[model samples]
Target: MSVTIETPNAPLADAQAMNEVASSIGLDWVGMEGIALPIEIAGRPVSATVNAGIDLLAIENGQKGIHMSRLYQALDELTQSELTPALIKSTLTQFIISHQGQASCAHLHFSGDILLSRPSLLSEMRGWKAYPFEIDARLDHQWMLTLKIGVPYSSTCPSSAALSVQVAQQQFSLDFDHQPDAISVQQVSDWFDKRGLPATPHSQRSWAWVTVTLGQDAAQFPVTELINRIETALSTPVQTAVKRSDEQAFAIANGQNLMFCEDAARRLYRALNNQCHFDQVAIRVEHQESLHAHNAVALAVWKRGSHAA
Candidate 1:
């Protein structure tokens, strides 16, 4: 008589719902992060990693962990449509709606690259350039959107430029000190062809990482316009496609736009200040020194009036 009675197929208890703990004292952000999803940026399908979170107060400590699965599902549904400011706002709103009275703020972060065809500096050829960009959206008492980008350009040190010019002058005097007549074209060309006759300034590939927050006046994300302003301000953006003529032109541009990290930061700080749409701007300029072992770095922040951060 050792027959076993059949048990019920499933558990009769909902552990996650019934097992409740004390409330959290203060949790600034709580949610899933590094969620890999496919999203559309600028009408192109791109892979994006999403980080979403919500603030948990002491009154609502730990019930079921803020329904994290709901936040993930909301973002996953957004991959079907192209990412825009409106979509971000809607997604953040959905988070609050789904959480009801549990969450007061919702935040989302995603990053991807935008591929663009950039025309050559001097040639008619165009080449593809991939620009890494990131967007942050937060919905609480107010809505905020921020964009960040990294621009690479050539940086020639001011001191190096002066020294290079002096070197060339010394070499020229050594070659034609006794000549009474002006140097001929052939003679100047030969002087240039000589090895190490005119010292070239030391220039290194540098980077500018800029983050800007849009004020209420801004309607759409001005990605292309922001990129243009940065590139034009630096004046020595790295070239994509190059020919002999293009290389020569680039050399002249570099000579004209010689800068240090301080100069680069100042240039961007002023440029961003003039834009009404940009309320707060953060600039970081890094020069990977070709001559020195340490890098040159400069940082500047521009905030509107007394609201600066």
Candidate 2:
């Protein structure tokens, strides 16, 4: 019978003395990443990949490294309940307190696709939509938080609409072989009924990515409101589970609200600028043009102050 000796708990590798040279340099950020964390947002358990880090600027001369496990433990303890602004602030506090005199900064980054239900236009039916979102929270001398979201919409080119109208007028002249002063109203009506449209404008799928610095209660992300503003500004949103009526309404809206990349960016800029809750806002509009092989992109930023970021 052989007995194995248990490893002693004392004199651990973490308890070893630090090298003077190695202990002198301060680390800006050090900690865990890709931590599988489930956060509760708006009563839903949100699966998030969290990146937690902290600055070891206050490390004493004798200390070689800060305890990385402390940050993870802080996250685990606070996240067991739920994720909220207050909980985030508390977790950062725990990270600083765990180090006592070593750490002065803490940051947490989480990103995931949140599932939300959106109602169909001109229909009572609703469908689920997954929106990619990112939330970044930092704590140091002050606290900061920002949220980013992606919104997909339709962009009808103004130039393309004008050109289409011009071509349709020429097509009408050729089809009837008569001028407005000579053709009867009944003849024009019959021609329109037989031929659906002389020419159709070219449009393509588009996207808008927006970021906002939040200054209010962050218990829930304002994804719906942000999406509404973006779609309203552009006047043409990509439909989900589109019915015939919804498709017709969408086509009419697209025709009424023709825009280019620059127009899209400016409209979003103006829409976000009116919101007081967002301290700093930025938007990028991407129009995947069906007319050209290249995409048209525009970015705009607006701040609460005299400048933009």
Which number leads on lDDT? 1
Candidate 1 per-residue lDDT over residues 1-309, each given as its tens digit:
698757778666544344245665656799988989898776667777889988865554355557788888898667877777788888899998987867799999988777777888888977877777888989999989999988888999999999988989998898899999988998888878884546778999998888989886565677777778999999998888888888899889998898999999988887787777787888999999999998999998888774342
lDDT comparing candidate 2 with the true structure: 0.81
| Candidate 2 segments whose C-alpha is farther than 4 A from its true place | 1-12, 15-20, 58-62, 77-82, 178-186, 216-220, 307-309
Question: What TM-score goes with each of the models?
Answer: 0.88, 0.87
Model 2 clashes, total count: 0
- Can you list the residue pairs that collide in candidate 2? none
- Put down candidate 2 lDDT per residue, 51-154, tens digits, no spaces: 98888764446576777787887788645775677888888888888877677898988887777777788988788776677888899998898888888889
Query: At residue 6, what lDDT does model 2 achieve?
Result: 82
**Where does the lowest 10-residue lDDT sum fall in candidate 1?**
13-22
Worst 10 residues of 2 by lDDT: 15-24
Best by TM-score: 1
